[model samples]
Target: MTRDGAGLRVGDRPYRVFGCNTYYLMAWAADPNLRRHVDEVLDTAVQFGLNTVRTWAFNDGEDQWNALQPRPGEHDERVLEALDYVVWQAGRRGLRLILALVNHWDDYGGRRRYAAWSSTAKRADDFYRDAACRRCYRHHARTLVERTNSYTGRVYRDDPTILAWELGNEPRCARDPSGLTLQYWLEEMSAHLKELDPNHLVGTGLEGFWGKWREGRYNPPRWLGGQGSDFLWNHQPDTIDLMSFHVYPDHWHMDEKATMRWIREHLDAAAELGKPAVMGEFGKRGPRALRERCFRKWLDATTSAATDTEHPAAAGALFWALYHDDYPDYDRFGVYRRHESTVDLLRSYTAR
Candidate 1:
């Protein structure tokens, strides 16, 4: 894997990361009966001309239903084997993956479990500053990075199928509105991941929300999650190879123009940092025409971003999810089954 300007290159070929989110692959890929569905998703992704994907690498302390690792340093061999199969399958299909190491939310016993394990009170921000918490996290991360893929008999660090490693799913520190703690956490974790595997890129899975903190204690009251997350300043870490931001205009009640401007501003920031950027996760629930219009505008701007300027062009855009209708409790986020128009739009730009 080589960095080519604002994008990536695999063996001298420019790689455009037009893709979608499939966070459940690790769990499903681990099951033999459900493993075929993993294949189906990748097949459809390739069919739609999507070359990259974003999925979860860590599912900590969850029940039997979906748990990659029931407890820290104790991985479910079945799930681990399934994840190995998923990696092999993606490599076979010639698709890339961006695996998130943790979740900021409580989906899979995230920070809450970590705090409990460390015998500390549940504070979302404590995961960043707590020494014991960081140690446990590092142990888990080290195990994953150094583990040899069962399918290929190759360590994950040497696997080219992995495009990058995201720190968390939309990480935030609501308590640290000043942005110092979150920034420090990004620096520490990113550096840790880089040390473990320098071949793959690392990113802070942040929802692009800019605020004033480093220069002075100035956080906008209207920030996205009542958390202190600065899109511009956070991506300034030396360990961060690219900038990742999620867009949810419809959910945020943002208009097309506003969403378009959000894309441009984040791209500009990436250009300033001399790093590539990707729309890691974005989508909405609404009529087909509206989704089409919004996606078309975003895709056009993303594909047309100028690469010659100091700021590099946008690297890629991955939609919220791609799930099939038959899947259990599927949230109806599948691109192939839900909206044909959006699929067409993705095909058109990804082929470029």
Candidate 2:
């Protein structure tokens, strides 16, 4: 059940996914009563016509100064519980989930010092050192899907509540890595996930680097997208189901039109893969007009991608976040203002 040409077939055609990243879903899973909170967040998403929710399952919230490793299912108890409830409650709220498996972006929103993080020239040494870490991630992902599928009380598997499975939020780092190494990880991780829960769609998390590489412009720079991961991103689309990516108008808050143009180009570039080109991440700051413009540009970009341009393979778009907690107003990129309004617009781009 997939749609679009990017290797992602759909249960239904013309399915334009919409949702937000549960950036801190696991970090604050300390409350004894998390059901309501999860419902509230997802509730807002459903209320505004959202179709999905993306959350990170790795990073466990510990300071990742040294080699990143969790306490072997340390937060699994709470994290899975929250997810189970998210599926249950989200259904009640009328929403789905496009869950991310791992992430390198930290609180500072710059560099991540996680299990696979590395300096500009350094490699993901920790990933190489502790085989257990990788194994844990693979196993955990399998369990996540299995549990979701096993849900009996309004089961989530066959329902529309569960979206595609994302493998690694930006598998490539800010360093030039051996293409073989990165590909090996992506192929293996993606395979492992599908083997366990063959029901959901799966794909790697990219920074739109595939399109950027083809266009000769980039965000995290050339060194970040792996030595040559673009080949696999386009040529080997079958390794996963869809082509997912992230993007943000560099250092500009008024590039709504520009953002649309870039996404259109990305879709064109994805022509060969014949897959749905999805913007996994994007953001902006400045006047509300600027943000709304950029958002609208991308919204229009998804519903109608260009052909033979920089990108013609695009399929959908997912905003960076909908911060559900009280945080500083440093970057006004969030769609909401410490309230649920931000989350609302984040998922309101329906084609109705």
Highest-scoring model, TM-score: 1
lDDT of each: 0.79, 0.57
The worst-scoring run of ten residues by lDDT in candidate 2 lies at 108-117
Q: Which ten residues in a row have the lowest lDDT in candidate 1?
A: 212-221
User: What digit string (tens of lDDT, one per residue) describes model 1 on residues 1-352?
Assistant: 6666677677887666788898889888876788888898889888788888899888888563668778756788888888888889999999988988888888877776777667664676698888888888888888889989999999999999999989888888888888888989999999999999999989788887876443432222356535778887888887897788887875577776677777887777777777778888888667667777777887777777644444556777889878855664344434665457777777788656
Runs off by more than 4 Å, candidate 1: 62-64, 213-221, 306-311, 328-333
Q: Write down the RMSD of candidate 2 (Cα, Å).
A: 5.2
**Pairs of residues clashing in candidate 1:** 30-82, 271-311
TM-score of each: 0.93, 0.77
Candidate 2: tens digits of C-alpha lDDT, residues 113-212: 3343322323343442246556767665756665543234544445566777778676553343445455666777777876776777776776555433
Question: For candidate 2, what is the TM-score?
Answer: 0.77
Which ranges of candidate 2 are over 4 A from the true structure?
4-13, 26-30, 33-35, 61-70, 73-75, 106-130, 148-160, 211-235, 251-261, 306-312, 325-331, 337-348
lDDT winner: 1
